[model samples]
Target chain A: MSTTARTVVELIVNNHPGVMSHVTGLFSRRAFNLEGILCGEIGNGTQSKVYLLVNNDDRLEQIVCQLEKLYDVKEVSVRDDYDNTIFTRLHDLVTNAQ
Target chain B: MKLSGAEIIINLLERQGIDTIAGIPGGSNLPLYNALFKSKIIRHILVRQEQAGGFLAQGMARSTGKTAVCFATSGPGAVNLITAIADARLDSVPIVAITGQVAHSLIGTDAFQEVDTYGMTVPITKCNFLVRSAAELLTVIPEAFRIAASGRPGPVLIDVPKDVQLQQIEFNTWPQPGKKEGLAYFDNDALLRAAAMINEAKRPVIYAGGGAMYSGISKEVIKLAEKNGIPATLTLMGLGLMPHDHPLYLGMLGMHGARYTNNIVHESDLLIALGVRFDDRATGKLAEFCPSAKVIHIDIDKSEIGKLRRPEVGITGDLAAVLPVLVDLVGADKREEWVKRVETEKQKYPWSSQNADDGMHPLEIIKEIAAASNDDAIVTTDVGQHQMWVAQGYPVKSPRTLLSSGGLGTMGFGLPAALGAALANPKKQVICFTGDGSILMNIQELATLDEHKLNVKIILFNNGYLGLVRQQQELFFEKNYIASHFKSNPNFTAIAEGFGIEAYQVDSIGDLKTTLPLVMAKDGPALINIYVDHTHNVLPMVPPGAANLQMIGG
Candidate 1:
């Protein structure tokens, strides 16, 4: 069995109707699947934070580079060393609820 | 001045210079249709299905390089347009899709004809809007057009609730259309570095893509290649960038590319990829693609520069702006020895067939079409063996004339898109090159063709099987052909006649030669069905998961 590492990509984008689609559609069009995604409106409600959990591969850097090119995307950063326990915890809560 | 939301939307579209729209009307969108009747400025072409409307808009946008609009009512009408919207997004075609919604008061109540349009379209559109009030329509209408046509163009959706369309608001002044801005950002240092790489390379190849044609910079790209005496190979989307007869032009390079072209790319020392994302189909088994070449990637979209393969120099700017600067810096130089080597490979594996006397060949039919049209016709194709055959056999002399579903590989795009192209360029001859299987996917659009009486010539390659899939199964699955063959196919000529289109059927080369000229001169829609050899396969095909150099059968 092979092991795959997961990394979180954090993005700050203008809070608008299609910003999320533009960001995520880029990955889907490239045939890259995201593991998990978390998003909500943040500071002053004008901007939103989007966290995308994706496999850590050589293609990750390229995906991050593409995310930065979006017109509505204010900033993008790859948080490789950040704690990923939040996803694991959420997964467990959903499984327990089911 | 007081105006209803529907009126405001129609007036704003007129301000954007939109004189034509493709759409269908339903209950939820009756108010907008009512407003459209009052205005004689916008001519609405009624399409039978909502999806065809979307592709019709795509045809106009792609053919003219302008923002086109399409409309659909709530529920299934909106949902049916999803495939075409996604196609536009993948291919970067600029289109605005206006969809109607249930009344605002019916939010989340599972009301009649109400579905989550905003939620369903978010992942497919460049941007989408769900207007809350009638006053918001003022800003949303113009913004949708702006976002759709702006940097790296794609489709945008605006879903207005029925109640908002009925509401009225007063405003003294109308919102002006936004000014267009260029997305390219010049970087001189990177240009110099790329120039230096070009000057030092012994074996260089220019890889051009769809973005080059989208930006109308094929002249600059061709100039750079000719100035440096470098051979150029186009991606599927970049087919018409260089004239087919240009000396330095190698045919498309990818899985189904010419054997010599793939060999040249593999042996090259430098690759100047412009506006091309190193897609997997274009670069079979990435590890071995351009193995010895150092890449210099340039694109308007920053992320595309280093997304696939890490380039030695990545310039994130417009090709129109960057290519000229790089050409000036590099100046003129010649690599005769490299050009000679490419010629040697081309001679070693010539694109000629020995089966011309056996039966009707698809390449012969394409060549016949090319001869009759003088290589100047706007050729759109559906995906499959026929698409590849057209790519190989047809000689495209100009850019934007060869339109196909490149990135998305969507079938059923040709017929409706040809309708759109014919409408955009009324004087130009448009031809739809499709296969038996693909033509049936959206055959309903024949009614639209009959209604408009558009002069679109349909060339159908009938093999009675899903040719590409059958070929794959024959090679990989030990000839276990299941669900690949048509037990009994319809008489396409009869079907075309029923649709009021002039029709002909050809089973031999002689028939094709005689029928082609007569059909070409015909003033209305015509369908020429050419039956091809069922066992004949596209040559020089690089199998999946293999390197470009590992192609079998030339």
Candidate 2:
């Protein structure tokens, strides 16, 4: 019921230049919350797995639908049950690094 | 066969049946131009400015409902193309733009005339690509076309580095030419519920947008409006959906809409929104627009359904596939009382242009053009007061006949777009309505028109000022009138003649009777410069951040 509820959107996309921009630009352009992102190429370096920490707001469905429309974005899934600390622990890691 | 990247790009475009491409050549794109020189199947038009080339492609795309292509070099050329590409994106015109980027190895080094085109185009394009190798063109080129027109049409850009254009690859088999992706599957229960929503309403209104035209479903939507005795009001992009004289037609509804049309929409109990996004320009102060209405929205794009306004029943699919099903499912009714009320509202406040005394008023000029040209004639307009006047007064007989920059409201669109239309539909005349301010934005396109020798008649309204900005200043900013007035404007008739096209200078509406027929009947391009008074404002305007009901002038 909270507006600040956290979730992760996992994306399977083509591994190449400009794919990251296409994925991140969606959040910036639409003003959707993207608190954190984790990505890398997978399986023979032809595909990538991207995890975006975002707000679980009313716009999440529309956000997922828009992401699915991207040509390089092969698959999109919203993981409400995934451990969001994968992103939250980053704050502690950065503080300790300093 | 071994083919260079530039040759492969040209081959892919030719294989897609692209006959004409508008572009400008520079250092980065020299290789691509060299390949274009040998293509017997494709012809290129050299535009003076890079931005107009993008719009030239939009004209062909918007008028024909197909994906059109344009070309440009990197950096400045690609930057100049941003406005037109953004315009196409907002208006949903399908165009594939191929720009020549710097060498792939020198990408981050900031080499001469190099810019991150893929980065710049991300926000404005449906999707964009930075081609890394020559082999990638085999799939990327076709995919560009597919992604452009797949569902909701939009612009697509592919930035190819200079090195790639020279790189060669060998292949035995060619890939299939790209076509639009298949239509989405329909939900039967949504259609049934939408029909019930229409059947239950006592006072229903149909609000259609450019999607109706994009889907080529004008006849079905018009049938629904006529059969159910419901009034239909169109957005600026949707003007040609219904004939102007149709009894069920309620002109345009928005900021400058006829008082009655806006009032009727405000009072309606049901709004059947079709292929429309409910843009801010159409729904002034969205919180209060159609406050009493329950909406049933259908569009091809899924995100647009509830993006701005929530609908009682939302269906995400093409109107071509959706409208006919709803037509059969809903029971027809006269609803004479509601129709009578709408007619009375239309008569009482009425479109201000309806009572014109046949003078040199902009509305009269539009009517004169309508009278002189045949039904097949196409019209394109630039942004500002004249654009709104034409949208408010012109009698567009069919969809795609009226080409306008509705979503982005880009000035300088009329000239090049009209040129593209003239090139595409050579048999039909193209009438371009442009104001002095808008004309000067891309006035160099007159030379492109002269080179083609097509039938395009440019009607210029020389008001000696940015009329719309002046009007807004007068209303909203207490008539400060800063930077709105032009102390000196060019003699456009002389300018047109300098471009080697026929030109005429007229003073009054009576003068149009003589010059319009001569220009409209001529075989080649012409320009008619008519004198108009400045400070003339488009009326029935809703003040900034105000509701549709709170209007200041008519």
Candidate 3:
């Protein structure tokens, strides 16, 4: 059986060479294999949304705390409202379809 | 009562006891750099990229145990720094990363040089702040430092919007007191139970981690381990937590752990894990690992307990706090049989290349480097086979003497990390141990070293290949050396010279002995490229998914 774990991280960054470089650099450094990453604009012109899927849930707490300390990062939340909202949305869609 | 965001940042850093800054400026952060031009209170290091700036901060933090700061501009510049920031967080180094954001109004309009840097770093920092208003600057700057330098120290980020940078605010005379309760506290009950378990076990072992070094509790850890007559083993990050030559020392324990250390871990009745997160690399096949032992896990992070392999006794507090209690409770008693058994094992598989009299082995090179340094120098290494060899062969006499990538295993970590260490502790000699493959990753840092004239010795173990990858290929892929071999490699000695660093090339053991002393004597940064046979391998490696005892070497 294939092994798997899940973690969610939110990043707030200023859009720009090495921003992606910095993020990818971190993942490689921590040896945290990313399952998936989704990013988008948020909060009216000042911030963006980054949803990271990491393989190690155990390290999420520390990872989240550390992420909050980066220069361009405004805040970092490991367990955000997005998970619940997504779950609720999925549930609503299933019920309405039925 | 007027100040630019950059001026406020420099002033805040000076207030927090930071005298040096490492960074590069881009269009977005130019205003701050302009402000820094007039400030003499803080020294700014103009690095080529923000990535190296972060690593330099990490090295400074690692050596000094103080929060080091780095800066960058928006877009790629800010992002380039994430690697080093995550490295600091994972290794528990106190670091502060400051990046310039594009104008707040253009954040979502996809303006030039605008990227979501704050969003990108959310997963790798302890806390981060976006300076939406100049009024918040005084409060946020000091808070970031407090958080980064506090218990279980790690990285913190502060993003300054361009508008905020151009605004003005009154500097506060006194910053708010940092959170106190969030800090870890030792429970007396857990400490008592841990002591009792150690007292009862016949074959007990102490597994120390980087926390011991971070807390400056190596002596306390050694005292407790010695009092109970427990054999001690350290994680790669925990190198120098105890003297490698100490009688109870069992070398590093992990995937490339010594054969006897792994065997003893398997046979022990009790294992005292201190400040170590049970990383998969350390505890191979966790279910089958140390099955007979009653585990006692002690760490500052409570979540680390019962997360991987459940421990019978979990003590969530600083190692510095609990180690003394353990020593006092468990009085000194010599376990002659246990000590004798470990001594016998040590004799059986000594960590040396005794048979190599003519050819230069990596282990021999590491030993010579350690011997020449007087055991008082600080040694750091980048990841790969060379890192393991250094961990296995170097006889460390003091704590905080060895710094290397443990959880991250970043390949190009050595040179930049050594630069940071050298800058942090100017009085002591610092050395960088790296493989030929790993060294090329950030070889440009040679310019940074030469610019500052740092006294860091770079020892490049050149085997004409990615030695670790080649070893893995040989062990797992039927010896099919595909892309692992590098046929036309740049002469590192010449490259160092090109970057203005003194360089040397050693081909034989005789040449190595003659050149090593000269390299050691140089007052500025120097690189010694040692060409070894491509056939050398790091031994005692455990096959993936196998029991710890089923190691390759004797």
User: Lowest-scoring 10 consecutive residues by lDDT in candidate 1 chain B?
Assistant: B351-360
Tens digits of per-residue lDDT for model 1, B63-130: 88899999999999999899899999888889999999999899689988888998888777877889
Compose the digit string of candidate 2's lDDT tens values, residues B310-390: 999999998888998888888888899999999898778857644366487788888888899878889999999999899
What is the lDDT, from 0 to 100, of the residue B83 in candidate 2?
90
Question: How do the candidates score on chain B by TM-score?
Answer: 0.98, 0.99, 0.96
lDDT of 3 by residue, B399-433 (tens): 77788877777777888888888888888899899
Q: Which stretches of model 3 miss by more than 4 angstroms?
A: A1-98, B171-184, B353-358
Q: Write the per-residue lDDT of candidate 2 for residues A1-98, one digit (tens) a residue.
A: 34248898999999987788888888899988888999888999999999999888899988998898888899999998788886767778779999
What's the distance in Å from true for residue B298, model 3? 0.9
Candidate 1 chain A, which ten residues in sequence have the lowest lDDT sum? A1-10
Off by over 4 Å in 2: A1-4, A91-98, B353-358
iRMSD value for model 1: 3.4
> What TM-score does structure 2 among the candidates reach?
0.97
Candidate 2 CA-lDDT value: 0.90
